[model samples]
Target: MSVNGDSEQQDWPRPSSSWIDKVLFLGTGTSGQVPAIHCVTKPDFGDCAACKDATLNPTGKNRRGCTAAAVVGRSAGDKQESTILIDCGKTFYSNAVVHFPRNGIRELRAVLLTHAHADAILGLDDLRAWTMGGVIQRHVPIYLTQECMTVVEGMFPYLVDRSKSTGGGDVPTLQWNIIDKDKPFTIPASQGRKEVHIQPLPVLHGYFGRSSPFWCLGFRIDSFSYISDCHEIPADTLQLIRGSQAIVMDALKMDRHLSHFSFAQALSFFASFSPPPALGLLTDFTHRIEHYATQEQVDTWRDGMLAAQLAGKAKLSRSVGEGGGTKWWSDIWDERDNEHQMTIRLREKYDPIDDHNISQTASHYIPPIKLSWDGLVVPFDPRRSPSMP
Candidate 1:
């Protein structure tokens, strides 16, 4: 299939100018991310499944690092169009530059942070470079749950410091807007006269054994909802996203994970919701899985089994109206696997994408590269590859 370069920044299966506005899955990998600096350094490091096969990776000409999600509206004549970002992971800047270049994005209206994990928020520094160019004059509004804000302040003291009189630092010139979990709020849209309502849907993070109640918030933008780093979906939260046109969520692979959703878990979650017009998997992978092998093997498996079952047995219907009753067959699964060992089966009639396995899966199988024995094959050492680490 011919890949669309702008699909990550534009709405999937539809153009950006579509009725529901634009929702893009900028970055979907897990904490360590794919083609990790560690994995990339290995001597036998070959091509990346997501990059070479999935077609989800950006073009070779302009490669930015990290993962992120962006939502843009269709309002015209608005100079400062509002663009919202969820989870500013370590690769935020490079990912932003690649998917949303300075010229493409006119304004950086707000940011909603799900938690304080390094992969989720380290890219805040890259905003410093954007400010120097004069696109943003004041601190951009950063929305976070009270608990998450505390974690950010503790981790990146300089960025959240309210004491700095001059407001000059590596931070992305942000105006902190701390939000309460489960509450809906309004953010000014592209046109100052208009505003977009965003509802924060809270979910769990981390593993059960070491499970600390880390707060992760998903945003409901118009008909689209974005949720990442979640373990379970509460009934109320599911209600909130019931009729959403699209849901960009975390599918950490096919394995049964302690914290995140496995492919089966994600599919189960998707099954519960009224099928949205589109379904894209974000925060979709990790580094332990073999990109190439997984994609080919899983696609073959999905076409033969999962797709047939869904076509034959899935009873859920899609919602009706612009944002009302659900339609059973409109469900779309833009599955992005990131965890290890997780495998997903597509519903019957759905043709599995070639790069489906580029992301993570719940299955615990190790990649060929990592299975080497001493002397026979040298293990990949991160210290040797400067591109990574």
Candidate 2:
């Protein structure tokens, strides 16, 4: 599907200088956060770094759920500040409380939701606490896509219900503004002196049973775009973010899956948007692909992309993975090569097992795999026999 260019620009309010300085990446991840509830509740839950502390490494595993919000506008100090939250996942309330403390923010302006998934909107109730306690006394305006609003009202009846009396004198009230996909809207920022234009980019979520359909979306905030829980990135959406400074997207894992973009797919997507300032993969928290696997997957994809360039489909002129705190793409690729050699050397250290049976039989038996800086592989499996090949 393509975006209507005419509609996107028509009636668009001119951006003010005050709005330019605001924006921060609040949270990033898929619906089920890292170190999921099951992980923490399981009897044999090992001492995982993420499990040990929630704030130090706020990932999908350690955080409440997968949601990101950005705040916009200037702070009370009159410094230009504007933040926008991409998704409001289950732990949004607590995460927000910790991340954006009362002393830190002068206002909690708008919340933009990417989709209607549970992890994205479950924290709607928590805003009430902020409202009731006189923390954010003013009505907070929430902007959502029309499709998302339908799902929100259907899923959260109480929040949308105007008749119910919130026992706490006056609960935090929400003003909903339905955003038209075809048209862009400006949110008041910089203490209402500036406006930030938000454009909705349509994407495909997993299909529903037999005949029904579900819609997912990503938002383009000026030069940055955030898309999570999507299987495919539509061409039109790509066009909208053609020159983005950063594109934060979902890279579920290494292997191909039916409903999500595997790490390879994510790399392909990044290649499609070649030469972007930076690209970050989020919404990752699966045991199948541990931290090492995630980095490996990234390396594999980068290598593949580089290889494809020989045939001319890829023409990356700048260094990849360098802009972000992530290592340079060349460094990662070099590491991958080193890792391959190390894997060969360690071959005798691991018992050869069928790939298909590895998950069912040896997943838990094996310790976490570590990827060396030069790309060497070390099998931490204690079950390895000296005679093993």
Q: lDDT score of model 1?
A: 0.52
TM-score of candidate 1 against the unseen true structure:
0.67
Runs in model 2 lying further than 4 Å from the true structure: 1-25, 37-64, 71-79, 166-170, 189-192, 210-212, 300-389
lDDT of 2 by residue, 1-389 (tens): 00112232232222222222333334444565565566567555555444434434543323434546463433225445555556666777666665465225545657777778787787777777656656654566788888789888887766777666456535457778888765667776555445567778777777766364466777876555567667766656666765554455665644555556655445535543533432334444433334544454444444343433332333233543312212223321333333334221111122233333332332111111111110111111112111100
For 131-235, candidate 1 gives per-residue lDDT tens digits of 654655555678887777777777767767636425454445667887888888877654353665678877776544653665577777666666777877666
Quote the positional error of residue 229 for candidate 1 in Å.
0.7
